[model samples]
Target: MTETFDLSALKQSLDAAPDHKNLKPLGLQTIYLGRDALTVLPDVVAAMVDATPALGPVAVLSDSTPKRYHAGDLLSFVTGCIDARHRVRNVTVGVAGHTVHADEETLAKAIRDCDGAACLVAVGSGTVSDIGKAVAAAQGIGYIIVQTANSVNGYADDRSVLLINGVKRTIPTRWADVLIVDTDVLVKAPVEMNVSGFADLIATFTAPADWYLATLLGMDDSYSPTVVGLARNQGSALLEAAPLVPQADPNALEQVAKTLTLSGISMGIAGTTAPCSGMEHAVSHLLEMATTKAGNETALHGAQVGVTTIVAALLWQRVLGEIADGGLSRVRVPGPAESQAAVLAAFHTVDPSGAMGAECWRDYERKLARWAHASERIELAKRDWPTHEGTLRHLLATPQSLVAALQSAGAPLRFADLEPSVNEADARWAVANCHLMRERFSIADMANFLGIWDDDLVDELIADAAALGSSR
Candidate 1:
C-alpha cells in the first residue's frame, strides 16, 4: 500500500510560506486519503456530530445517481456508516438520469433540504460536493467531502463552479472540513472519469503563465510562485503516471489524486482560481453554456478543459511569437461600449435573454477598467518583455507535451473526441470569445489587446493544435 499523504506537513509548510502571509485561513481541516479511507467516515462523522451537538442531524448529501462502491452502492455504504452512530439525513439532490448542476435552483433546493444539519457529508463526485459546500456555507455548518472519483480538484478547495445567469462562475463556497479519497473507491470509478482528472490537471502547464502575465500587466495583484509550485513541481510525476491511470493502477490514481488536492489548495491559498484556470477554462465554460442552452448533454468539465489547455498553450506560443516580432508596439484597447457590445453579441446566441451577457459584462468590465488605467504597467511590461517572456516560457509547457500526457492517459485529444462531441463551429465560437466571458486576464486577453485575436488568429491556433493531434 502507498503511504498516506501527510496533510499536517503540507499545512505547516504553507502556513510558514512567505508568499501566503495575508491570505485567508485554510478552512480544510483534514484530509484522509488512500486505500480504505472511507472506513474513517464513521468516526469522523461521530466526532463532528458530537462537537456540534447544538446543530441537528448529520446530512449525508448526494445525488440520486447510483455509484459503485466496493461491491455495493456507494451512497448506501456511506449513509450506513454515518447512520450507525449519528442521525443521518439522506439529502439527495438531482434526479437519477439527469446531471446535477451547481446552479441557483439546485443549490436553493439543496440548502433547504440540508437545514438544521450538524455537519454535511457530501458523498459523491464534483457536482454533489459543490452543492454540499454551498449549502454548508449558507447554513454556517461544517462540510465534509467524501470524494468518489479522482475527478476535478475542486473537491479540496473553498470554491464551487456554479452557474450565475447561465454562465459558469467559480463562486466562493466554504471548504470541506475533511476530504476523504479512497483508492478503492477511485479505482472502481469509470476510467474516463479518472482520465478526465488527468486532463484537468494539464492546465497547470499553461495557467500559471496566465496568472503571472496578469500580474505583469497589472490586471491582477496575486501571483505566488510558491503557491503555483505546490502542484507544478509534480508535473513530471503527473506526466509519468498518465498512462497508468487508464489501467486503474492504484499508485497512479493516488499520485494524481494527491497532486490534484495540492492543486486545489494552491488555488485556495492564492485566493483565486487563476493559478489553475486560465484561457482553457473560459473556453470550456462557453462550450458548457452552449450545450446547456441547446438542451444537449455536456461533456465532463475536466475533459473539455484538458483539450482546451492544448489550445491555450498554442495561443501562448502565438502571442509570444508575435511579441518577439514586435507585436506589442501595436497594442490597442477598445472602449467600454465597444467591448460591452462584443460581449453581448458573442453571448446572444447562447442566451437570448441577455442575462448571461450582462452577468459576464459585469465581471469583464472590471478587467477593462484595469486595462484602461494600466498604461504605465503595460509600458513597463513592454520594456521588460524579454525577461517577462522568459519567465512565461518557464511557466508554460509545450503544446506537444500537454498533448502527449493527454494521449498517454487515453484522454480526449480534440474537442470532437469529447463525449457528445463539441462541433467545430461551436468550438471556434467558444475560442473566439473566451476572453469576453470572464474577468480573468489571460493570454487570450493579451492577444485581444494586441489586436491579434480574431477569427484568423483562432483558426491559426486551431491549425497549430491540429499539428499536435489536438483540435476541434
Candidate 2:
C-alpha cells in the first residue's frame, strides 16, 4: 500500500516558507489521496452541508455518459453516498448528445439546475470539473471534486478552461474545498486517460523555461522560483512513476496524482498558468480549435500537449542555436498593424466569424505594445544572452528524453498517434502559428523576433521530431 498524502502537513510546510507569505493563501482545505479515498465522500459531504445549513441540497454534477465504478456506475455511487444523509439534487451537463464544453451555455444550464444547492460534487474528468468549479462560483456554494481519472491537473486549481468566443481561455474560478483522488477508481479508468495524465506533466520540463524567458524579455514579471520549485522539484520521481502508470501501479499513480496536485497549486499560488503552460499548450489549443471547428473529434488535451512538448523542446533548442550564432543582435519586433493582419489571417481558417481572431489580437496587441517599447530590455538580454541561455537550457528537457519518457509510458509520441489523429496540414499550422494565438512570450516568440521561425525552420523542427519518433 502507498502512503497517504498529508495535505495539511504539506500546506504547513509551504506556509512556513519565507517566500510564500506574500502570496494569496490557498483556499483548498483538504485533499484525500489514497487507495480508498472515495469511501470518505459521504462523511465529507455531511460535514460541508452541516456548515452551510442555510443552503439547499447537495448538487452532484456530471455528464450523460456512464462511468464504471467497482460494480456500479460512478455517478450513482456518488449520489447514493451523499443522498443517504442529505437531500441530493442531480445536476447533469452535456445533455445535447455531444461532448461537454465549459462554455457560457453549459454554465448557465448548470447554474439553473444546481440552484440553491448547499455544495457541489463534481463526478467526472477535467471538463466536468471545470464546469463544476464555475458553477460553484456562480452559485456561491462549497465544492468537492471526486477525481475519476488522473487525466489533467485542472481539477486541483482555481481556474477553468472555458470557451470564450470559440477560443480556449483559462478563467479564474473556485477551488474545490475537498479533493478525493481514489486510486482504486483511477486504476480502473481507461489506460489511455491515466497515461494522458502522465503525459500532461511533461510540461514542467519545458514551460518554466518559457516562463523564465518571458521574465528575461520583460514581457511578464510574474516569474517565481519558489512556485516553479513546487512542481519542478519532483521531476525525477515523476519520470520514474511514468512507466508504472501503464501497469496500473497504485503507488505510482498516487505519486503522479500528488505531483499533479502540486502543479495545480503552483499555478494557483502564482496566479497564472504560465509556470506550467507555454508554447506546447498554445500549440495544443490551436490544434483543438481547428479540429473543434471542423466538427471532428478532438484528441485528449493532455495527449496533444504531450506530443507538442517534443516540438516545443525542439523550438527551444533552435532558438538557443540562433542566439549562439549571433542572431540575438538582429532582433526585430513586428509592428502592431502587421501582427494584427497575421493574427487575423491565421485564425480566419478556424473561425470565419472574425470573433476568434479579434480575441487573439486583443491579447497579442498587448504583447506587441510591450515589445515596441522594450529596446532597452532587448539590448540588455542581448548582452546577457550567455547567462539567460544557460538558465533556459537547465530548465528544458531534450526532445530525445521527452520522447523516451512518453514511450516508456506507452503514451502517444506523435500527433498522428493521437486518437482522431491530427493531419500534417493542421499540425504544421498549429506549430507555426502557436505564438500568434496568445500573448505569452515563448521560445517561439523569441525565434520569431530573431527571424529564425519561418516556414523552413518550422518544417525542419517537425522533421527533427519525426527523427525522434515524436512527430506527425
| Residue-level lDDT tens digits of model 2 in 1-472 | 2335566776787788777764556778888898878889999998998888656889999888777777778888999998789899998888555667777788889999998899999999899999999999998898999998888988888999988888888989988999898888888888888899889989989999999988887888888888888867677898888889999898888888988988888888778898889999999989988887777778989989999999999988878888899886888989888899999999998899999999999889989889777788778888878888888888899998999998988889887889978898999999999999888888899899888888998888877877787331
137-234 in candidate 1: lDDT tens per residue?
99888888988888798998899999988999999988899999999999999998899998999999999999999999899999988888886867
Q: State the displacement of the C-alpha of residue 470, model 1, in Å, after optimal TM-score superposition.
A: 6.5
TM-scores, all candidates, are 0.97, 0.96
Error of 2 at 28 (Å): 1.1
Query: Candidate 1: lDDT over CA atoms?
Result: 0.88
Residues forming the 10-long window of minimal summed lDDT in candidate 2: 1-10
For all candidates in order, the CA lDDT equals 0.88, 0.87
Candidate 2: C-alpha lDDT: 0.87
